[model samples]
Target chain A: MTKKNSEAWKKKYEESGLRDADFSSISGRLLEPLYTWEDLAGSDPETRLGWPGDYPYTRGVHPSMYRGKLWTMRQFAGMGTPDQTNERYRFLLDKGQTGLSVAFDNPTLYGLDSDHPLAAGEVGKTGVAVDTLADMERLFAGIPLDRVSTSMTINAPAAWIFAMFLANAENHGIPFARLQGTLQNDILKEYIAQKEWIFPPEPHLRLITDLMVFCRDHVPQWNTISISGYHIREAGSTAAQELAFTLADGFCYVEHALKAGMDIDEFAPRLSFFFNSHLDFFEEIAKLRAARRIWARHMKKRYKAKSPRSWLCRFHVQTAGCSLTAQQPEINVVRTALEALAGVLGGCQSLHTNSMDEALALPSEKAVEIALRTQQINAFESGVATVIDPLGGSYYVERLTRDLEEEAERYFKRIDALGGVVRAIEQGFFQREITRAAYEYQMGLSRRKKILVGVNEFVNTGRRLEIPVLEIDESIERDQIRRLAEIKERRDNQAVRGRLEALRKAAAGSENLIPPLLEAARVHAALGEISEALVKVFGEYREQPFY
Target chain B: MAEQRIKVIIAKPGLDGHDRGAKVVARALVEAGMEVVYLGLQQTPESIVRAAVEEDADVVGISILSGAHMTHFRRIKELMDGQGLGDRLLTGGGIIPTKDQAKLKEIGVEKVFGPGDDLQEIIDYIRHWRAAQAR
Candidate 1:
């Protein structure tokens, strides 16, 4: 566009009486109201975007994309007893859901058992309670282990839970090579955002590397670490911060494995990602596209990864829970649908659309069904999946994608200068950035600078929330405790003690910890017991006040 | 003579990992000229009360987003009363329903804030509660 035309456009916008706003992306980056080819001026599309399934996979990781296979509709569901969550899993799968994402309860996430004092009233409240191999078996009861892919959103005790899963699979006669799933084993994000960490960073990395090596040899189809930005975003980080911090964490893992004398190609292909699909339509899409480009480029160039599979940044997208509001909860459906669509358009391999009522409580069955149906409609009816990188080469998308890439590159340099992610996390850099961003966003809402439907605007104070909010019966904790007590009574006490002692010894020295952890799980060692054994050696991590 | 600042112990008293609300509230309290001691995640009620007693806090704010508010708050209230600290204000804010919040208030919780409750209003409530306690 000519300078005169641009000036005329600006004058027209000004004279139209539209209020001057921040015009920024949710990350506080100023967004141009319009974009032209001049924005992407000298960039060559062939070299930058290229075709799908190629190096620097900006467009997509798959050549055929969704035309070959629709993105997996994995709804993250769990609550109440193991039987209840098992029923929900079968229900979701019966409704044509392709995969299962397990959301463990708070106790499980913190490596505590349902019978622990701190677990009072919390057992099976947030998600399924799996304290031992028996609970894990019941959690997936009747679900064919080999036929389905399961993603466990457990971090701190991921290895323990993973061992329990493997034990459960072995009981079902499924080979380790046949097991396919992702572990939210990204403990760095725990330190930075989720705060579910047990041991300090160094030992946590040790546990993660053990899982990585074990999975690389045994569970070849498994994604050992889904380096996640989902919690980072839920902790109120901006899109750029989420992208940069997540990739930086991924780089740290790769560097760790390399230092341990592992080939990049052997494990890089199994390293997956989980990202948040937020409400900003263009920005979220751009973030995903930029994420793929950043991962592929860095893997091929920086890490010198040799294989094409190693360069893929395969990810699962969950529609942002932080964007869902407690007020006028139903409209969250629209928000989720749009975000899921962005995920599909941005070429996500799988997606989990959150329930509308999640901001209030654990999702009711009806709410979860609606969430699953949101993805169903997007994939089958929206006609969006038939095309690969449908938004490729669009002026705004390309410009924003490139801009986000550049911003993330800048963050990478800063993080490297801060001595990488672990040091940055210990120094509370990530926490500080996210806290400031969250505060600024809250301030924007209060100042009327941001318009959230049914919140601070549209004025829905009178409307009652009509949807059912699932309430966990307190009996769930009682039942879980009783079951745990039974397991403790019935299990071979000598064997359990022996295995736990072995695990503690393994933790004390430099050993691959998963084998001992698996042995403990095989002997009916509780999750909390395994975590405590390690805690005895590594101690617990307590964060200093950052705000 | 030195003026005393209101000491508020902000804590997460459950296995819940969400601390965005707690941190934001702590920062607001600090900016409002209160001495805020933030006890980070996975804190049990015993530990929280211990911190409250050790810190000599005028108020204890427990932030729970894990839907365990009823059990946690009741246990904490009982523990605080058992420890002869019933005069202190015990309050919190998160995903608690209005009806449950009212029940908690009836059960000895001083105030239970929910979503979109004004930050200034929280500041004012804490200050007013401390002033009333001073009397």
Candidate 2:
């Protein structure tokens, strides 16, 4: 009877003649006019999607999900000097932000001090600059490290920054066991998508494995690596590419750590993922769902992770920065709200909503507040957090979830065929794929296949909307350099020199570099100095520039 | 005689790794039948100007989203002037604000494109500049 009704509806639908439009997801997946039980085929929900908090956690990671506790509202914040960013963090915390996510400036991200020549105009510009433990101290002055969980978006120099963070926490008399935070130390994605790196892949993976082992032994509560697809999507990869590449990187890390002799259950629990919640609502949700299921299956069967914690794939989501338009900037608030909702519906552990004016500048205080409030409204008023996997049983969502998993699986096989993630990265496979996708996306916008509202369609040609852009004071650079100079004058230079020498020795040998790094941070060694020591040993990485 | 295609060099200055805009614009310029050289990422103002002089490019375009555009543009424009490449157009795009765009113009940047701008608009701008220069 259902088949007969579906046939009749299809006949009627053809006769009715739908409007001419690109009826496809933003990722270019064609949409069906209607979905039915037949789309699910012989897949049993009992195995494919068990109960929430159970095996193959497709429904949700936790049984209670957001009912017991809501997702952490962690907004990625930083600008200007450490003191200024501290004020912003204080403001955010006071405004009911649950977690702190640090955004370091490009110089700091590249392991350079604020006073470095390449760091001239970039000092305290895009994000906060921390050159030493003193700067890290000022960055978290009022905020107690023990109380709130922090997430630092530092890769390449993640070890240095994280060591500085630990040194700061130790000065605050906070025990490492009590501290909770995350390091965005996923280096593989940096080479493939973000294009930020210091050392080559082999040495970089070694640093990551060392950190994983260190975190397992010491900072047990801290998430060591946020295997990120956020930048992959931001770099203009399709949703499936993001899913596939991110998981592939995650599995590679697991393989590396396993080879390094760390037990799967020991560090895998703290292995977190970060995804970009793009404009496509259902697609984003399905991607997140499929991510949890795939990770869980691989951890249990393939890797043989004994602990259930190892199988759980916890992730943080940020609203797609690429989706925000410069024209009609106010509409970005609407875009961010919808994207944030997708993150919630898709089961993100933490969320960072991009400010409306981010497409213009970093984001003024006013703009950031509104972005934070958007999450508050969703959590409290929208009633979305009241249920776990609300769209789980829906045929359309399930079909998409299954389809995304299959697509990601196909990519995994391809990546495996190309040796592995690092090898593929060396071969420029990921870069070529992403550049192709990014080019195609632009072509779509130009050809009118994709509509970006104010950009391609809604025509806002009268005058540009003058939203308040957060301007970093020019003097911050001079002030930051002076502060660094002062620290250099005050610090025990002999101790710093000794510590850096030890770090270089450790980097040269197969010894874990974190203990020596932490020792260097304790002596108030400059980030650039320590990085120079390591750079002498590991050497630098220069990309082939595929695009 | 074969008409000369407008020569354009698109480079990303500073440490900002966001290259979606740079790559897209480069591809668009190539698609528009322009002679294009893409200096991928982490380029300094000196390197950009040096490349522009060596290539004898008609236009030197930079894509900067690191909020260091003010310093980069000023330095690149200065270097271009010093290197005797002052006649060439210095144009680029990224997440640049209106006021900064105005400031950049006063400092001799031809034009700064932002989000939602038509690819053809940029293509036309380059073509028109080349045509006017020939006149």
Local distance difference test, per candidate? 0.90, 0.92
DockQ, Cα level, model 2: 0.75
Score chain B of each candidate by TM-score.
0.95, 0.97
In model 2, the runs with Cα more than 4 Å from the true position are none
TM-score leader: 2
Candidate 2 docking class: medium
Q: Per-candidate RMSD vs. true structure? A: 2.0, 0.9
lDDT tens per residue, model 2, B8-105 = 88998888888888888999999999989998888999888888989999999899889899999999999999999889999999989888988988
Poorest 10 consecutive residues of model 2 chain A by lDDT? Answer: A538-547
Residue B71, model 2: lDDT of: 92
Model 1 segments more than 4 A misplaced: B1-5, B54-56, B127-135
Error of 1 at B63 (Å): 0.7
